[model samples]
Target: MTEPSVPHAPTAAFIGASWLALVAGAATYLIGLFNAEMALNEKGYYLTLLMYGLFSAVSLQKSVRDRAESISVSGLYFGLCWLSLLLALLLLLIGLWNANLALSEKGFYGMAYLLSLFSSVAVQKNVRDVSLVRQAAPAK
Candidate 1:
């Protein structure tokens, strides 16, 4: 017989989510800032978002496989991440092509950064939850 596994409390979950968000947000911000010159061209923004979407999809799949459990929260997170990235890319393109949109893009980018941060944290939490559930389940 196997011992039961412990799950994190809601408070712990909130703290963990916040920390993950902060770390991921900072990392993404730095990556974008450092690579702006090389990576922020009209087409590059779309390409970058596309790449992120693809990578996230793969990661989500791997997480599901590792957990051996279906978690709708994971799917929700990936969808949000892709949506946020697409919005950011669209705003970036508009900024490049239109002056008015350029001003909005600045603000949009900031919000997008926040969204990315939150989404990262959410995904992390969901993955952890799924893993815990899988571990706690009795052997078949």
Candidate 2:
């Protein structure tokens, strides 16, 4: 019989880049928020959106990976993960569309928000891959 395949660990460069992207995206978004001359409530809304988006993205990624590995994931939970991520995106878009910000500001927030969400998923995947590779390694 053929041996089971081993999951390869992600390269150090990839891991570092994923982390850097996550940090840069998050930091840039937060800094923009801090510098924006908006009302406190508006800033809170954007902050909450960023947090929600990141959490949902990471959760969805984990759920998808688990399903791919034949792990038992409840259909309801998986569906919610997808719904939450979509909702977060929708809310951000609607908020931006209605906000009293300039076009460049809106674009900045949108780009940073997307970057953060994407990078968070990448970071989560790298972490999971590294864990799997370590677990598959035999003790010396």
Candidate 3:
């Protein structure tokens, strides 16, 4: 029989970096939005998208992990998780594409948005992995 896996803690550097990247990306995006020449309504739209993207990304990551581990994940929920992630991305792309901002501003927003999404996923995965590892460990 295969030996049981041990619960290993995440490296301090990885955890710290993941958190830092997430914060930096999100902060940069928001700061850009706050200083943007767009109307308040436009700012609201982008802010909502960011919130939705972060939530959906994390949910998708968790659902994916659950499926990978053979845990029971409902098909509808799983499908919704995927749909939300895609929709969020599509919405961001469309918004950025149609905005009147200069190419540089557009590029900056796009990069920040993508960085935030990617870092959020990484953060979610790291948290989940650490949780599972701890749960598997015997009480000392």
Best prediction by lDDT: 2
Which candidate wins on TM-score? 2
Whole-model lDDT for model 3 versus the true structure? 0.90
TM-scores for every candidate against the unseen true structure: 0.35, 0.95, 0.92
Q: Which of the two, 1 or 2, has more lDDT?
A: 2
Candidates arranged by lDDT, highest first: 2, 3, 1
User: Using alpha carbons, what is the TM-score of model 3?
Assistant: 0.92
Give the residue spans of candidate 2 off by over 4 A.
Answer: 1-5
Worst 10 residues of 3 by lDDT: 1-10
Q: Once model 3 is optimally superposed onto the true structure by TM-score, how far is the C-alpha of residue 82 displaced, in angstroms?
A: 1.1
lDDT of 1 by residue, 53-100 (tens): 434544554455444544344666766656665665565446445533
lDDT of candidate model 2 versus the reference: 0.93
Q: Which has the higher TM-score value, candidate number 1 or candidate number 3? A: 3
